[model samples]
Target: MTVYYCSASYYDNCDYWSTSNCTPPGTYCHRGACGTCDNSYYQCAWANLSGFPPENSIADTCGSSWLCNDKHAYDIPKFSCGTVLWVQDLCNDNGLNVTIADHGPYVCKCETNCNSVNLMRIIDLTEAAYIYLEGSFSRGHIPVMIQT
Candidate 1:
């Protein structure tokens, strides 16, 4: 149970740190040289199922509590946190259309007219086939929205 997000005037459960810090006793408010916000969880790093290196967040330590699992389920240092990428599993290539149609954001690719000259390469974050992302742990703060 480690969620730590502080700043609700002083984290006495200002809400949204994952169901009020697992319902318990808290008393930590410091948020400076590192953090403390009247305590409730905040010790990141661990959610690297062995494939997410590019500097997304990996320097862990902070424990109190935080957990959320829609069903695929996960909580506890249970491999840290943060993960979200479900564009139907990266556009389901099987049909060979990594992604293209540019006019509305679906211009992502790893192959297929993703550039033609074809070697498969064009992944700089572009998913607008209606845009829908929620894999990054998603507790709040989500903005890549493009609804047209």
Candidate 2:
């Protein structure tokens, strides 16, 4: 039940951002512009899927493979993360800012991207896609203290 806040890229700086109908049960997340080989044990495998759909169909309804994309496991969420903070602290902080259009709850497992407005979709998946956990949740970033 642990979680952490992953770092985010600057607003609208994506090399070439695009959108597609995710239907449901999925979303799109920006791993990188140049499509870096999301940390591998053997070696790097960066691709150049600047404006293409990922692999996991659910993540991106377009099914439109990018000229280049990185590996992934689950459907990358079509999320516009606001000034992300420790989910725990998020509950405590009263002065928190939720003005960023890039921040919000998040949509997943999209099938047609119709209902999920403003939510981006990515559909790139691979065997070594699990590495995404690195961007999952950190220790100090959130508010989950380790047990002594």
Q: Which candidate is the best by lDDT?
A: 2
Q: Which stretches in model 2 have alpha-carbon errors above 4 Å? A: 1-4, 11-74, 79-95, 100-148
**Candidate 2 vs. true structure, TM-score:** 0.17
RMSD of each: 18.1, 17.1
lDDT of 2 by residue, 1-148 (tens): 3232221211222212232443342334433333322222111111112233354233343333521123231323232212122211222222221111211112232222112222122222211221232233322122111110
Give the Å shift of residue 46 in candidate 2.
21
The TM-score of predicted model 1 comes to 0.17
TM-score of each model, in listed order: 0.17, 0.17
Work out candidate 1's RMSD over C-alphas. Answer: 18.1
lDDT per residue, candidate 1, 1-148, as tens digits? 2231110001112123323334353422222111211122321112222333323311122122221221111221122122222222222221111121111111211222222222111111222221223233222222221111
Error of 1 at 98 (Å): 8.3
Q: RMSD in angstroms, candidate 2?
A: 17.1
Q: Candidate 2, which ten residues in sequence have the lowest lDDT sum?
A: 139-148
* Candidate 2, residue 139: lDDT: 24
Residue 85 of model 1, lDDT score: 25
